[model samples]
Target: MESVRTCVGCRARASRSSLLRVVAIDSALIPDERAAIPGRGAWVHPTLECAETAIRRRAFVRALRVSGSPDAQTLIDHLQRNG
Candidate 1:
């Protein structure tokens, strides 16, 4: 059976494959396409709206359990580039 993950932004449970796995890189959020990055990861949909929502609500830091604010530009840029 496939694993299910929850989206920090939308707060919806979804298949792991349907959500994008993001990890902190230098305190900034980055997409882990292969979901192989180390450390804590926060899941979100591959869309700018979700990314923005996550940032606005500080979901990344809460979900990843990191200190301070985590940058979301890299993830936003990534979603924009690939969108």
Candidate 2:
């Protein structure tokens, strides 16, 4: 059986292996490619639109229960850098 996680943006359930896992660290958003980060994590589809929605809606903050927000550019940068 595949592990399933809910997308913070669209609330869609997806296989954990298929979704991109993002973790908040040092007050910044970091991509957890290994999904081994020991902190609050938010899931999103591996698409720019989903990432944009998550940022625009503050879904990451809500899912992570964080008070402050991370810069969306940082997230896009990370995605670009990693991809």
Candidate 3:
């Protein structure tokens, strides 16, 4: 069976392959396309809407259990280029 995860933006459950896994690295949000990163990861849909929502709502900080604001610009650029 496919693993399931909840999107931090929309708060919806989806198949692991259907969502993107993001990890926090020293206040930077990094997208883990392979989902092989070793750390606490937050799942979000690979869409601008979901990404923006998560950013606007400061979901990444909470989901990743980070101490400060994480730079999501890389994630935005990534989604724009590959989304």
Candidate 4:
């Protein structure tokens, strides 16, 4: 069976493949397309609304256990392009 994860933005449970895995690198949110990046990861739907919600709520920092605010523009840009 496929794994399941919760979207930190909408707080909805979904199949792991249906959500995008994001990781923090140097205090920046980076998309983990392969979900192979080592470290804690936060999952979110690959939609601008979900991505923005996650950023607005600072979910990445809390989920990734990172200090301060991690730049979310990269994730936003990524979603925008691929959304």
As for candidate 4, its clashing pairs are none
The runs of at least 3 residues in candidate 3 whose Cα sits more than 4 Å from the true structure, single-residue gaps closed, are none
lDDT of 4 by residue, 21-67 (tens): 99999999999999999999999999999888988998888999999
TM-score of each: 0.94, 0.86, 0.96, 0.96
Q: Comparing candidate 2 with candidate 4, which one achieves the higher lDDT?
A: 4
Task: Please give, for residues 1-83, the per-residue lDDT of candidate 3 as tens digits.
Answer: 99999999999999999999999887889999999999999999999999999999999988889987888888999999998
Q: Of models 2 and 3, which has the larger lDDT?
A: 3
User: What's the CA RMSD for each of the models?
Assistant: 0.8, 1.6, 0.7, 0.6
Q: How well does model 1 score by local distance difference test?
A: 0.91
Query: Candidates 3 and 4: which is better by TM-score?
Result: 4
Please list the residue runs of candidate 2 whose C-alpha ends up more than 4 Å from where it truly belongs after superposition: 81-83
Which one is best on TM-score? 4
The weakest ten consecutive residues by lDDT in model 4 span: 52-61
User: Any residue pairs clashing in model 1, and if so which?
Assistant: none
After the best TM-score superposition of candidate 3, give how far the Cα of residue 38 lies from its true spot, in angstroms.
0.5
